[model samples]
Target: MPALPRARLLVAATAAAVGLGLATPAHAAPETIVREEARTAEVVAEAMALAEQLAERQQTLAVLNRRADARDRALIGYRAVLSRYGYDGDPDTARAVLPLASYDLSAGFGLTGPLWEAEHGGQDFSAYAGEPLVAVADGVVTEVADAGPYGLRTILTLSDGTEVWYCHQTDATVVVGQEVAIADVIGSVGSTGNSTGPHLHLEVRPAAGDPVDPMDWMRAQGLDP
Candidate 1:
């Protein structure tokens, strides 16, 4: 090829490329292509927003699941306490457990002693000093103060509104308004107040009545006392 003809051929090819860039298809319009691209971008934005919303919902469900697990554990603990008191999962026929792990009656409920005002208002369980004294049933500690003849005493109010008195404690482990499970340690045995020796003086009083014989109450709870 000659030099002038080769240069002319290169110019013609470049012009044809430019014309191809400017040409439009017979069926497709420029405005339609632009509109299609805008719609695709909008769809992508909507999908991203929906993904974020799903992630937030999953986080909320995780928190709710944790709370429900904690609530279930608390319910199991409460039911175990009830079962120990001889409740066959029935609220109408629940029995009570003994207050102490082991004991011997040192003095009867009606025994006369130097500190007796009329008669003994409670039973004396002969236990060594510092023996753990527990609540007989599930109850709330209503009082943890010293009474006149019962030193270092603790009063537990039962679920049926019965009040139980634990007297002559060397030390009290519970406070007022504290909830106690069945057989939960509330105090230790000691000869406090007008006691003759180291023993636990227990009293049971109904919600609307005076102190009853603790021996009979213990018997009712299937305990020999």
Candidate 2:
């Protein structure tokens, strides 16, 4: 009977050991699953951040493309205007040229200042005294005389009957009714009449009417100045 009790104790100890072994593996499985989930979440977060950065870059590129398209359209429109004015022979000479080889823009049209009784009607090209001035387009000399406030001036009439005034000139090279082409030396800069400094005061009058902004007219002719 004592041997039977000892065998019963041995069997009970073996069974208890097996149960502890199974419980250990079950507890460890939950910890392993939590570590895997954390790694997956980290990978997903990194991917989301990279995707947001890519979207922002694409938006910036889209804005740049829009601005490029706008500039291209403006260039095309100005080129068309030049072609309509019969300047389409050579691409190099297709646009109207500047009157002076080197000069600075000093004043603008429609400005309110003490120097004028009314709003200023012309654009001023500031340069040294006796700087050579040239014709801006193909035209005939309409007037070349001394005016009270304009000093000595030269006027050229365009094919469209538009008059371009070259004011504050020391002297004029072209006479009345003489045809002049673009860039022909027409006068020299001065500070005569109601003047301040040596500058060419340029004016544009469409159809011999009131003066308009010469800068705007020059831009419409595909010329920047």
Candidate 3:
């Protein structure tokens, strides 16, 4: 190569220096680097705070769900108890119900049995001793006393002036004037009067008069024995 002119050589050297300056990156100042780091830290802190809030909300929702489940279980248990007594939610639409949950028809009314002096005046329901006895219909307790052969008895007068007698009970739970709804537990079954095993002697009387067939009366009230 031939030697270049001085002015041209100087101009070429200046152009090369300018190109090197454009290609290489400049070093950042210490204060600028620190500011960039602080900005990054701020962004990270905001993300962490949002994550914590979401976790707390999730925990709160879980607790609420647990409480709702517990309440549902309690309601189911309460409904089960009511169903056992034949209460179908609305009491006004319900007619009559069975006096006991489980029982078998034994000696019926007008049947001649050796356990009775004359013909049987009431229907007999064979059941276990100490079984809960419920009211057959809505009525007010008119009498609670012990008779000669009827044992511990309770007389409930219905709304239509019909009287129902619950005999052979272990004890009476109502007073003389307490109102009772259908399926209300009035007493328990027992052999209190005449000689017999655990049973209930149910009697029906119109206007508190002569005894009648309890099975037929219950059927009239839209219930089977």
Residues 1-225, model 2: lDDT tens digits: 001123332333344444444223444577775775465455545544554453344334434543553465477764443443334456456536677756889989999899987899899989866666777888999998876588778899988999999897766668999999776667667665577777889999999999999888988986666
- What are the TM-scores, per candidate, against the unseen true structure? 0.58, 0.59, 0.62
Which candidate number has the best TM-score? 3
The RMSD (Cα, Å) of candidate 1 is: 34.4
Worst lDDT run of 10 residues, candidate 2, spans 1-10
Residues 113-165 of candidate 1 have per-residue lDDT tens digits of: 67687788888888866666667888999998867567778899999999999
What's model 3's TM-score?
0.62
- After TM-score superposition, the amount by which residue 103's alpha carbon in candidate 3 deviates from its true location, in angstroms, is 0.9
Cα RMSD (Å) per model? 34.4, 33.9, 37.6
**Model 2 Cα displacement at 38 (Å)?**
99
lDDT of 1 at 129: 66
TM-score, cand. 2: 0.59
lDDT of 3 by residue, 1-225 (tens): 011123432333344444444222347677766775565455445544554453344334434543553465477763443455544555557777777767888988998867889989989999865667778888999988876578778899999998999887665668889999877777767666563577899999998899999989877866656
Tell me the TM-score of model 1: 0.58
- Which wins on lDDT, candidate 2 or candidate 3? 3
**Candidate 2, number of clashes:** 0
Lowest lDDT 10-residue stretch of candidate 3: 1-10
lDDT scores of the candidates, listed in order = 0.67, 0.69, 0.69
